[model samples]
Target: MNRVWLPVVAVQGLWLRSTLRLASAPGGGVSGTVPGPAAEPLRLAVLGDSTAAGCGVTGDEEAFAASLAREVAARAGRPVAWQAVGQFGATSRRIRFRLVPRLDDDLDLVVLLAGANDVLAGRGPDLWREDLTGILAGLADRAHRVAIAGIPPFIRFPAIPATLARHLGERAAALDAVTREVCRQSARTTTFLEQPAGTPPADFFSTDRFHPSTHGYRLWAQDVAAQLIPDQPAP
Candidate 1:
């Protein structure tokens, strides 16, 4: 079975509500209020692939955008309105083509979590770097605070084919390198979130082992929140 592109069933909405509740709990330490202008909620935009869209997770709330918004709001002491723009099989190239133009200048923060599809498509590092650079440049030029999430390790998942899995693993490393280089070159353009090693595939992924589960989005949201709020460290 060529399960490379198989779509994982979206989880139920109840799962999202439950996850949000847990993430919002005081013990969870996920909530943080963003203190700034009382002028409406801070607008946050997320762009990427299935992970960014919370494909494996059920409902929008279970996605990273929702969790991050909640956390940022709690910590920053302000309200946040999160907008997610993602596609299941999107790559960096596709993001450049489809998602970039839709971004609003009013967006306070932009989170980009892409490149896995580019890896699957066998895109070269140079091309990945080009597209990512252009994306970051566009955002920076507009004075939007941006953060680039590293591609998580996919080879550890059991559902993928061995050959494709191996390729993805190598590609992830290459993409990470290019991402770092771009971040260094871009002037205060994009912050890089390094994917932590040893994160169990099950904890971070859904049943299909491709998209992130609710837990996975939480983890990604934590990383994003840390970047947005330097005072708080991501666990």
Candidate 2:
């Protein structure tokens, strides 16, 4: 089946600057006055699994976080500093263990792209929800604006057993539902992007068929940038 995925929307450049200013006030570590003519870049924090870490991709530029930073800089007319905390095979549980203690209130935006590994590991949906909730709460306590990317359908990928693909796809959909509910309940965050299931596989993924290829990361970056950037005309 041909699945039609939503094209990512373009965001306004100023949004990045505003987010940065909020994250780096006088009280916080971020310093220097917000740029007037030249908008300051946003400070983005990404936390999650191998995908967020750019596992299949070769270099940093190919990583979603890095590509996002570049896109924001290009459109925002300023620089962006993105901090990514990702681990291969990391589940929401492991991410909570690693990222919670390190969080600071100075972060402008936080992206939570996770849960695939959890499903692959046969983790329960309730457990995934619990861990994800904890992570969101922690970020809120630190006073950061957040966005959660829905777990895309993985069944279409070249990897994984065809029998397992259907099951995995269902699991991913379940996780996406939970994520949507969590984002709805949380006032501090938003779920601005959704990568739908059943889309034709992109060549951007790596040989493992698990992680994004440079092209894949770039497409992901475009999706993210559409949401994170301020209002820009649709492409």
Candidate 3:
């Protein structure tokens, strides 16, 4: 059973934490518009962890927020004004308390990338559900629509040890399941974006071999754009 590898996994997890250098979170782009057909730009806020912060890339433009906003703008034919709000290793609980309060009620769309930090912290399912539910509920009151990113398949991440990744992957799936259920309950205003399938290639990661590179974020944006735009316009 996989439990036999827990010792090795624990050691590898510790080693990775000590040796791998984490990328810094990027900032700027207070206001701008992605040209599209609509008169008013679709205001977008990309929130949560490293994914939202675009940690592995050189600048904010190369991160997920800009890429996803552009993707949504192109497909929806609406100019998008975007903001990237995130911390490098924040969990859902932290985002709920720290970032969620900073948002205004005028956002047209919100995409949250969370749960990986919770998984790494070994947070329990009940707490994850509470934190995630709080995050979604708070955003629902602010944004016209709330879309959440499914946790990535850690087992496929080249930087992670297979034994540890398998465990984390299973946990990620559990958290994703909880998130999907929460979204289902609020089907009118919230949607869950599933993580892309298949094993990730080397190019999917940055130089740190941990966080996503610009290439990976672009690919993810394409998938998110296709899924989010077709939903009914939020009231």
Candidate 4:
């Protein structure tokens, strides 16, 4: 099926790339604090690609990284100090090599929002699994806990044409399967997080119809918060 759709997907992808302008990443320091009464902050680092960089939103505060920090802080009843380390067209291999080196040690949490580029580029699951394993191994030395954000739903994004989206979505699924196994094997310090169920795709996307909007960020944060701080009290 992918062979049948590959040519069409490629043509449509080229057209979309030429026609749609990529959104700019939010400016300023990618680090911030979600205010709360707790004296100490739960440190967080979000590492990955464009979505991790909060490309769809204009400001850093409106991005999903901030939302996730707030959600975690509110639930944990502690302030959250967070930083989003991301690039526009980064792959899992880049994340393992480039971004992981940028993190500080003894952090509370680290979440990886990778795999979209890997899937879209049609990279094989073996390469993805290898990169992910390396990333996790490095992250283990940096943070106490790590969460792997599952691959994005390419088929649901309005910006993606149907044929191309289907192929990408299947690829995403394959990558995610590898991610899940990696997380499970590294279960001592890692876990995988999925997209929030019941989220409306129309509202979740931004003007580009590819990256996440502010609403999407909040929804995603809430879902992540639940998983990341399952034992923490609700705010």
Candidate 5:
């Protein structure tokens, strides 16, 4: 361990404890079947960490995956069957090791929200890339389209100490860069980099100030759905 990181690690431990107590655990998986008249409903899977599991929000409807499904359904005029598989504090490697093996086949889309935990855990970009290679390869083989959402803006997260925020922000940016490269390398993948969208901080973030609130989830879903569903042809 770098000697300079010692104090940061100590602060991180404290922050981690506080985050756990304040941010709800990502326990039950999110799943729903949106009804439609299409012959085959769109099959979607979301895999990643706390945000993908919807740590800050209550109910599946309020989470990013479900909100995205609703948006896509409305755009495509078809039913969507979506499911989310994630856990709190899951790094990229953990998702590859644990979540990838259980993913269903014949998925139309798979959305991945990772990297923040990897950055916070001090994992380097190489490891992040290796993990994503495995995760994306699996999803690419199984799903028609794989979408990679950018890591959460840790620097802007209200729960983190200002002293540590700059350092964390740098790491998050590095990880997001790696994420972008991974997506770019694959033709089937779509990438979304999270940035300030002019939405009020209080409106988007939950009480924990780390994970997204329902409104935040909505914003993210809108972007994801737009990418998944292209503009319809003129009638």
Candidate 6:
């Protein structure tokens, strides 16, 4: 089926890329201080691709990384100091090799949101698992906890054509399964947070219809907050 759809997907992908180039807006970095009243400061790092970098939103406060920090702080009663390192088209392999080596601080938590590009690029599940294993190992020395953010519903994204989206979504699900297994095998790696596929795509997506909007960020943060501070009420 993918063979039959590949050419069509490729054509649509080219148009989609051009459209995104024109439609995508500059998203502010969601790094630095996420203020709270708690005396203890939590050092956090977010590592992955565009969604991890908060591509759809304009400001840091509106990005998922910043929103998660704020929610975690509100729930844990501690200040969360966070830094985000990601780009729009980065793959899991790139993140493991290029991005992970540059980290300079010990962190309380690290949130990883990637694999969408990997799925789109037709990376296999075995390779994804290997990359995830390496990524978690790399983070073991840097953070006390590593949280894996599961892939979104690529099939539901309005920017993606249905045929390509279905193939990508299936690949994303396969990669996510690998991620879950990797997390389960590691004590330092915690939960895999995911967006429900049943969700209305329009409500959670941004104007560009690919990356997350503020609403999506808030929802994702809520999920992360629940995992980070399980005892506290959901934010």
Tell me the spans in candidate 4 whose CA falls farther than 4 Å from its real position.
Answer: 27-29, 199-201, 231-235
User: How high is each candidate's TM-score?
Assistant: 0.76, 0.76, 0.92, 0.92, 0.85, 0.87
lDDT of 2 by residue, 1-235 (tens): 1222211101222332234221111111112222223555577777777766667655555667777777766767676767777767778998888855665567778787888878767787799889988887777665368888887676666655454566667878788888888877874466646773346446866666656777777777777777767567789
Q: All models: lDDT?
A: 0.69, 0.66, 0.84, 0.84, 0.79, 0.80
lDDT of 5 by residue, 69-124 (tens): 88988898889999898888899999998988777888988888888889878899
Model 3 root-mean-square deviation: 3.3
Window of ten residues with lowest summed lDDT in model 4: 20-29
**Which segments of model 3 are wrong by more than 4 Å?**
27-31, 230-235
What digit string (tens of lDDT, one per residue) describes model 4 on residues 92-115?
Answer: 999999998988778899989999
lDDT of 3 at 194: 85
How far does residue 219 in candidate 2 sit from its true spot (Å)?
0.6
Where does candidate 2 stray beyond 4 Å? 1-37, 103-105, 196-202, 230-235
- For model 4, the local distance difference test gives 0.84
lDDT of 6 by residue, 34-119 (tens): 67775868998889888777888888688878888888888878788888888778899999998888664689888888898898
lDDT of 3: 0.84
Candidate 3 lowest-lDDT run of ten = 24-33
User: Could you tell me the TM-score of candidate 2?
Assistant: 0.76
